[model samples]
Target: MAITPPSNRLWWKEPIHGIELGWIVIAFLWGLFMFFFMIAWHFIGEQNLSTETYKVKPERYQERVEAFAAEFQAQDADGQPLEENGVPVVRPPVGGDAYILARLWEFWPILELKKGESYRIHLSSADWQHGFSLQPTNINISVHPGYEHVVTLTPTGTGDFGIVCNEFCGVGHHTMTGRIRVVE
Candidate 1:
Protein backbone atom coordinates (compact mmCIF):
# COMPACT_ATOMS: atom_id res chain seq x y z
CA MET A 1 0.00 0.00 0.00
CA ALA A 2 1.19 3.55 -0.76
CA ILE A 3 2.33 5.49 2.35
CA THR A 4 -0.17 8.22 3.16
CA PRO A 5 -1.48 10.19 6.14
CA PRO A 6 -5.12 10.39 7.16
CA SER A 7 -6.97 12.85 4.92
CA ASN A 8 -8.37 14.65 7.97
CA ARG A 9 -5.92 17.18 9.42
CA LEU A 10 -7.34 16.49 12.93
CA TRP A 11 -6.69 12.74 12.63
CA TRP A 12 -4.20 12.93 15.55
CA LYS A 13 -7.07 13.91 17.84
CA GLU A 14 -9.31 11.04 16.74
CA PRO A 15 -10.57 8.74 19.54
CA ILE A 16 -8.98 5.30 19.85
CA HIS A 17 -11.08 2.24 19.07
CA GLY A 18 -12.89 0.78 22.12
CA ILE A 19 -11.23 -2.61 21.76
CA GLU A 20 -7.75 -1.08 21.52
CA LEU A 21 -8.33 1.10 24.59
CA GLY A 22 -9.59 -1.88 26.56
CA TRP A 23 -6.47 -3.90 25.70
CA ILE A 24 -4.25 -0.98 26.73
CA VAL A 25 -5.97 -0.69 30.09
CA ILE A 26 -5.74 -4.43 30.67
CA ALA A 27 -1.99 -4.42 29.96
CA PHE A 28 -1.41 -1.46 32.29
CA LEU A 29 -3.31 -3.11 35.15
CA TRP A 30 -1.41 -6.35 34.67
CA GLY A 31 1.91 -4.53 34.91
CA LEU A 32 0.87 -2.79 38.11
CA PHE A 33 -0.29 -6.09 39.63
CA MET A 34 3.02 -7.79 38.87
CA PHE A 35 5.07 -4.93 40.32
CA PHE A 36 3.19 -5.04 43.62
CA PHE A 37 3.21 -8.84 43.72
CA MET A 38 7.03 -8.90 43.87
CA ILE A 39 7.10 -6.59 46.87
CA ALA A 40 4.43 -8.62 48.68
CA TRP A 41 6.17 -11.87 47.90
CA HIS A 42 9.24 -10.69 49.80
CA PHE A 43 7.20 -10.79 52.97
CA ILE A 44 5.19 -14.00 52.43
CA GLY A 45 7.29 -16.12 50.06
CA GLU A 46 8.92 -19.29 51.44
CA GLN A 47 12.06 -18.96 49.33
CA ASN A 48 13.44 -15.46 49.67
CA LEU A 49 16.90 -14.12 48.97
CA SER A 50 18.80 -13.16 52.10
CA THR A 51 20.19 -9.66 52.49
CA GLU A 52 22.51 -10.32 55.43
CA THR A 53 25.98 -9.27 54.43
CA TYR A 54 29.06 -7.84 56.10
CA LYS A 55 32.15 -6.12 54.80
CA VAL A 56 35.38 -7.98 55.54
CA LYS A 57 38.88 -8.36 54.16
CA PRO A 58 39.16 -11.32 51.86
CA GLU A 59 42.39 -12.36 53.57
CA ARG A 60 40.74 -12.34 56.96
CA TYR A 61 37.80 -14.33 55.60
CA GLN A 62 40.16 -16.90 54.15
CA GLU A 63 41.86 -17.30 57.51
CA ARG A 64 38.54 -17.88 59.22
CA VAL A 65 37.55 -20.54 56.70
CA GLU A 66 40.84 -22.32 57.12
CA ALA A 67 40.52 -22.36 60.89
CA PHE A 68 36.94 -23.58 60.75
CA ALA A 69 37.90 -26.37 58.39
CA ALA A 70 40.86 -27.40 60.52
CA GLU A 71 38.64 -27.62 63.58
CA PHE A 72 36.11 -29.97 62.01
CA GLN A 73 38.15 -31.91 59.48
CA ALA A 74 36.61 -35.33 58.89
CA GLN A 75 38.33 -38.70 58.51
CA ASP A 76 37.40 -41.70 56.41
CA ALA A 77 36.14 -45.00 57.81
CA ASP A 78 39.61 -46.55 57.56
CA GLY A 79 41.28 -43.70 59.51
CA GLN A 80 42.33 -41.87 56.38
CA PRO A 81 41.68 -38.27 55.53
CA LEU A 82 38.32 -37.61 53.87
CA GLU A 83 38.71 -35.23 50.99
CA GLU A 84 36.97 -33.99 47.88
CA ASN A 85 39.14 -32.86 45.02
CA GLY A 86 42.07 -32.43 47.47
CA VAL A 87 40.00 -30.27 49.81
CA PRO A 88 39.44 -31.53 53.33
CA VAL A 89 35.92 -32.58 54.29
CA VAL A 90 34.69 -30.62 57.28
CA ARG A 91 31.66 -31.48 59.34
CA PRO A 92 30.59 -28.46 61.30
CA PRO A 93 28.47 -28.96 64.39
CA VAL A 94 24.75 -28.51 64.13
CA GLY A 95 23.60 -24.92 64.52
CA GLY A 96 27.15 -23.74 64.03
CA ASP A 97 28.89 -21.53 61.51
CA ALA A 98 30.05 -23.11 58.26
CA TYR A 99 32.55 -21.13 56.20
CA ILE A 100 32.93 -21.47 52.44
CA LEU A 101 35.76 -19.59 50.73
CA ALA A 102 35.67 -19.23 46.98
CA ARG A 103 38.83 -18.64 44.97
CA LEU A 104 40.24 -18.88 41.48
CA TRP A 105 39.09 -22.37 40.61
CA GLU A 106 37.71 -24.03 43.73
CA PHE A 107 35.73 -23.75 46.92
CA TRP A 108 37.92 -24.93 49.76
CA PRO A 109 37.01 -27.44 52.45
CA ILE A 110 34.15 -29.66 51.38
CA LEU A 111 31.32 -29.45 53.89
CA GLU A 112 29.40 -32.28 55.54
CA LEU A 113 26.23 -31.49 57.37
CA LYS A 114 23.48 -33.33 59.18
CA LYS A 115 20.01 -33.43 57.69
CA GLY A 116 17.27 -31.30 59.26
CA GLU A 117 19.84 -29.18 61.13
CA SER A 118 20.34 -25.52 60.46
CA TYR A 119 23.65 -23.80 59.89
CA ARG A 120 24.79 -20.23 59.47
CA ILE A 121 26.69 -20.55 56.22
CA HIS A 122 29.20 -17.77 55.55
CA LEU A 123 30.35 -17.32 51.96
CA SER A 124 33.07 -15.05 50.55
CA SER A 125 35.51 -14.90 47.69
CA ALA A 126 39.26 -14.50 47.92
CA ASP A 127 40.11 -13.05 44.51
CA TRP A 128 36.99 -12.22 42.49
CA GLN A 129 33.25 -12.55 42.33
CA HIS A 130 31.75 -16.04 42.15
CA GLY A 131 28.39 -17.70 42.16
CA PHE A 132 27.26 -19.94 45.02
CA SER A 133 24.84 -22.28 43.41
CA LEU A 134 23.65 -25.20 45.52
CA GLN A 135 22.25 -27.72 43.11
CA PRO A 136 19.05 -29.72 43.58
CA THR A 137 17.90 -27.18 46.16
CA ASN A 138 18.87 -24.41 43.74
CA ILE A 139 19.92 -21.81 46.31
CA ASN A 140 21.92 -19.45 44.10
CA ILE A 141 23.73 -16.33 45.30
CA SER A 142 26.57 -14.07 44.36
CA VAL A 143 29.87 -14.19 46.27
CA HIS A 144 32.11 -11.16 46.04
CA PRO A 145 35.58 -10.55 47.33
CA GLY A 146 35.75 -8.65 50.64
CA TYR A 147 32.13 -9.28 51.47
CA GLU A 148 30.84 -12.03 53.72
CA HIS A 149 27.34 -13.13 52.82
CA VAL A 150 25.58 -15.17 55.47
CA VAL A 151 22.66 -17.45 54.76
CA THR A 152 20.90 -19.78 57.17
CA LEU A 153 20.31 -23.14 55.51
CA THR A 154 18.73 -26.34 56.69
CA PRO A 155 19.06 -29.23 54.33
CA THR A 156 15.74 -31.00 53.93
CA GLY A 157 17.23 -33.99 52.12
CA THR A 158 20.39 -36.04 52.44
CA GLY A 159 22.81 -36.53 49.58
CA ASP A 160 25.79 -34.98 47.86
CA PHE A 161 24.82 -31.47 46.83
CA GLY A 162 26.93 -29.90 44.11
CA ILE A 163 27.98 -26.25 44.27
CA VAL A 164 28.54 -24.82 40.84
CA CYS A 165 29.90 -21.36 40.01
CA ASN A 166 27.27 -19.94 37.70
CA GLU A 167 29.17 -16.63 37.41
CA PHE A 168 32.21 -16.88 35.23
CA CYS A 169 35.37 -15.71 37.02
CA GLY A 170 38.38 -16.75 35.02
CA VAL A 171 39.75 -19.14 32.45
CA GLY A 172 39.33 -22.05 34.88
CA HIS A 173 35.71 -21.25 35.60
CA HIS A 174 34.54 -24.55 34.17
CA THR A 175 36.58 -26.44 36.78
CA MET A 176 35.15 -24.54 39.71
CA THR A 177 32.89 -26.82 41.71
CA GLY A 178 32.36 -27.77 45.36
CA ARG A 179 30.50 -30.39 47.34
CA ILE A 180 28.19 -30.41 50.34
CA ARG A 181 27.37 -33.84 51.74
CA VAL A 182 24.44 -34.24 54.10
CA VAL A 183 23.92 -37.34 56.19
CA GLU A 184 20.92 -38.60 58.12
Candidate 2:
Protein backbone atom coordinates (compact mmCIF):
# COMPACT_ATOMS: atom_id res chain seq x y z
CA MET A 1 0.00 0.00 0.00
CA ALA A 2 1.34 3.51 -0.91
CA ILE A 3 0.87 6.56 1.51
CA THR A 4 0.20 10.08 -0.02
CA PRO A 5 0.98 13.43 1.73
CA PRO A 6 -1.81 16.09 1.92
CA SER A 7 -1.34 19.26 -0.18
CA ASN A 8 -1.22 22.71 1.46
CA ARG A 9 -4.48 24.73 1.16
CA LEU A 10 -4.76 27.96 -0.92
CA TRP A 11 -4.20 31.36 0.79
CA TRP A 12 -7.86 32.19 0.27
CA LYS A 13 -8.93 28.98 2.00
CA GLU A 14 -6.37 28.86 4.83
CA PRO A 15 -7.77 29.59 8.31
CA ILE A 16 -5.46 32.49 9.35
CA HIS A 17 -4.29 33.66 5.88
CA GLY A 18 -7.52 33.62 3.85
CA ILE A 19 -9.98 36.25 2.57
CA GLU A 20 -10.64 37.09 6.27
CA LEU A 21 -7.88 39.74 6.09
CA GLY A 22 -9.79 41.55 3.32
CA TRP A 23 -12.99 41.47 5.35
CA ILE A 24 -11.16 42.87 8.40
CA VAL A 25 -9.63 45.68 6.35
CA ILE A 26 -13.01 46.56 4.87
CA ALA A 27 -14.60 46.58 8.35
CA PHE A 28 -11.82 48.81 9.71
CA LEU A 29 -12.23 51.34 6.86
CA TRP A 30 -16.01 51.35 7.31
CA GLY A 31 -15.65 52.04 11.05
CA LEU A 32 -13.21 54.90 10.34
CA PHE A 33 -15.60 56.40 7.81
CA MET A 34 -18.54 56.21 10.21
CA PHE A 35 -16.51 57.88 13.01
CA PHE A 36 -15.47 60.76 10.77
CA PHE A 37 -18.99 61.10 9.41
CA MET A 38 -20.41 61.41 12.93
CA ILE A 39 -17.76 64.02 13.84
CA ALA A 40 -18.55 66.07 10.74
CA TRP A 41 -22.27 65.89 11.45
CA HIS A 42 -21.74 67.09 15.02
CA PHE A 43 -19.76 70.13 13.88
CA ILE A 44 -21.83 71.13 10.88
CA GLY A 45 -25.38 70.19 11.85
CA GLU A 46 -25.23 71.34 15.49
CA GLN A 47 -23.58 74.68 14.71
CA ASN A 48 -26.56 75.93 12.72
CA LEU A 49 -29.10 75.47 15.55
CA SER A 50 -30.12 78.67 17.31
CA THR A 51 -30.41 79.14 21.06
CA GLU A 52 -33.40 81.17 22.31
CA THR A 53 -32.80 84.27 24.41
CA TYR A 54 -36.00 85.92 25.66
CA LYS A 55 -35.70 89.67 26.29
CA VAL A 56 -38.13 91.77 28.32
CA LYS A 57 -38.48 95.42 29.28
CA PRO A 58 -40.25 96.87 32.32
CA GLU A 59 -43.01 98.36 30.14
CA ARG A 60 -43.57 95.24 28.05
CA TYR A 61 -44.76 93.19 31.00
CA GLN A 62 -47.84 95.28 31.51
CA GLU A 63 -48.68 95.28 27.85
CA ARG A 64 -48.30 91.55 27.61
CA VAL A 65 -50.37 91.00 30.76
CA GLU A 66 -53.21 93.12 29.48
CA ALA A 67 -53.15 91.33 26.17
CA PHE A 68 -53.15 87.98 27.90
CA ALA A 69 -56.02 89.00 30.21
CA ALA A 70 -58.09 90.32 27.35
CA GLU A 71 -57.59 87.12 25.47
CA PHE A 72 -58.52 85.13 28.54
CA GLN A 73 -61.64 87.17 29.13
CA ALA A 74 -62.81 86.77 25.56
CA GLN A 75 -62.61 83.00 25.76
CA ASP A 76 -65.71 82.23 27.89
CA ALA A 77 -67.77 83.73 30.71
CA ASP A 78 -68.39 80.52 32.70
CA GLY A 79 -65.01 78.97 32.01
CA GLN A 80 -62.27 78.84 34.65
CA PRO A 81 -59.75 81.71 34.59
CA LEU A 82 -56.31 80.20 33.99
CA GLU A 83 -56.29 78.53 37.38
CA GLU A 84 -53.60 75.97 37.93
CA ASN A 85 -53.97 73.45 40.76
CA GLY A 86 -57.15 75.15 41.98
CA VAL A 87 -55.55 78.56 42.60
CA PRO A 88 -56.91 81.79 41.09
CA VAL A 89 -54.68 83.65 38.66
CA VAL A 90 -53.76 87.22 39.60
CA ARG A 91 -52.81 89.61 36.87
CA PRO A 92 -50.37 92.42 37.64
CA PRO A 93 -51.31 96.02 36.82
CA VAL A 94 -51.91 96.34 33.13
CA GLY A 95 -49.78 98.65 30.95
CA GLY A 96 -47.73 99.80 33.96
CA ASP A 97 -43.95 99.88 34.03
CA ALA A 98 -42.00 98.40 36.92
CA TYR A 99 -38.48 99.71 37.00
CA ILE A 100 -35.72 97.38 38.12
CA LEU A 101 -32.35 99.11 38.43
CA ALA A 102 -29.84 96.30 38.42
CA ARG A 103 -27.40 96.49 41.31
CA LEU A 104 -24.76 94.18 42.67
CA TRP A 105 -25.60 92.01 45.71
CA GLU A 106 -29.26 93.00 45.76
CA PHE A 107 -32.63 92.28 44.23
CA TRP A 108 -34.78 95.47 44.29
CA PRO A 109 -37.91 94.69 46.35
CA ILE A 110 -38.04 90.89 45.93
CA LEU A 111 -41.46 89.72 44.79
CA GLU A 112 -44.31 88.12 46.69
CA LEU A 113 -46.72 86.44 44.32
CA LYS A 114 -49.87 84.43 44.77
CA LYS A 115 -49.89 80.76 43.93
CA GLY A 116 -50.87 79.85 40.34
CA GLU A 117 -50.50 83.48 39.21
CA SER A 118 -48.35 83.85 36.16
CA TYR A 119 -45.73 86.53 36.81
CA ARG A 120 -43.48 87.79 34.09
CA ILE A 121 -40.04 88.86 35.20
CA HIS A 122 -38.14 91.36 33.09
CA LEU A 123 -34.48 91.04 33.92
CA SER A 124 -31.40 92.82 32.58
CA SER A 125 -27.87 93.18 33.79
CA ALA A 126 -26.59 96.71 34.30
CA ASP A 127 -22.96 95.81 34.89
CA TRP A 128 -22.06 92.34 33.61
CA GLN A 129 -23.47 88.92 32.89
CA HIS A 130 -25.28 87.62 35.92
CA GLY A 131 -26.70 84.15 36.67
CA PHE A 132 -30.19 84.21 38.12
CA SER A 133 -30.95 81.01 40.00
CA LEU A 134 -34.17 80.19 41.86
CA GLN A 135 -33.34 77.52 44.33
CA PRO A 136 -34.95 74.43 45.85
CA THR A 137 -36.45 73.94 42.39
CA ASN A 138 -33.09 75.00 40.89
CA ILE A 139 -34.17 77.22 38.01
CA ASN A 140 -30.97 78.83 36.74
CA ILE A 141 -30.82 81.36 33.92
CA SER A 142 -28.35 83.81 32.42
CA VAL A 143 -28.79 87.56 31.90
CA HIS A 144 -26.33 89.32 29.63
CA PRO A 145 -24.96 92.77 30.28
CA GLY A 146 -26.99 95.47 28.51
CA TYR A 147 -29.42 92.76 27.36
CA GLU A 148 -32.76 91.86 28.87
CA HIS A 149 -33.94 88.39 29.96
CA VAL A 150 -37.65 87.76 30.25
CA VAL A 151 -38.90 84.80 32.28
CA THR A 152 -42.37 83.71 33.39
CA LEU A 153 -42.74 81.87 36.65
CA THR A 154 -45.71 80.39 38.51
CA PRO A 155 -45.15 78.86 41.89
CA THR A 156 -47.03 75.65 42.64
CA GLY A 157 -46.76 75.81 46.43
CA THR A 158 -46.37 78.33 49.21
CA GLY A 159 -42.72 78.60 50.12
CA ASP A 160 -39.70 80.86 50.17
CA PHE A 161 -37.78 80.48 46.95
CA GLY A 162 -34.25 81.85 47.08
CA ILE A 163 -32.85 83.62 44.07
CA VAL A 164 -29.07 83.42 43.96
CA CYS A 165 -26.43 84.36 41.41
CA ASN A 166 -24.74 81.33 39.93
CA GLU A 167 -22.29 83.24 37.76
CA PHE A 168 -19.06 84.92 38.88
CA CYS A 169 -19.58 88.65 38.42
CA GLY A 170 -17.56 90.84 40.77
CA VAL A 171 -16.29 91.08 44.33
CA GLY A 172 -19.77 90.59 45.78
CA HIS A 173 -20.91 87.76 43.51
CA HIS A 174 -21.01 85.38 46.45
CA THR A 175 -23.21 87.74 48.45
CA MET A 176 -25.73 88.34 45.64
CA THR A 177 -29.01 86.77 46.71
CA GLY A 178 -32.74 87.46 46.79
CA ARG A 179 -36.02 85.80 47.74
CA ILE A 180 -39.49 85.19 46.30
CA ARG A 181 -42.44 84.63 48.58
CA VAL A 182 -45.24 82.44 47.24
CA VAL A 183 -48.46 83.21 49.08
CA GLU A 184 -51.53 81.00 49.59
lDDT: which candidate is best?
A: 1
In order, how many clashes per candidate?
0, 0
> Could you tell me which 10 consecutive residues in candidate 2 have the lowest summed lDDT?
92-101
Which whole-number lDDT from 0 to 100 does residue 143 have in model 1? 95
lDDT of 2 by residue, 9-126 (tens): 3445656656867899999999999999998997777343223345555345434544544443221267656443332233343332222224576554345566876665666665
The lDDT of model 1 is: 0.93
What are the C-alpha RMSDs, in order, of all predicted structures? 2.0, 14.7
TM-score of each: 0.91, 0.49
**Per-residue lDDT tens digits of candidate 1, residues 1-184?**
4389677768779899999999999999999999999999989987886789999999999999999998899988897878866799999999999999999999887999999999999999999999999997869999999899999999999999999999999899999999999999
* lDDT computed for candidate 2: 0.59
Candidate 1 residue runs with Cα over 4 Å from true position? 1-13
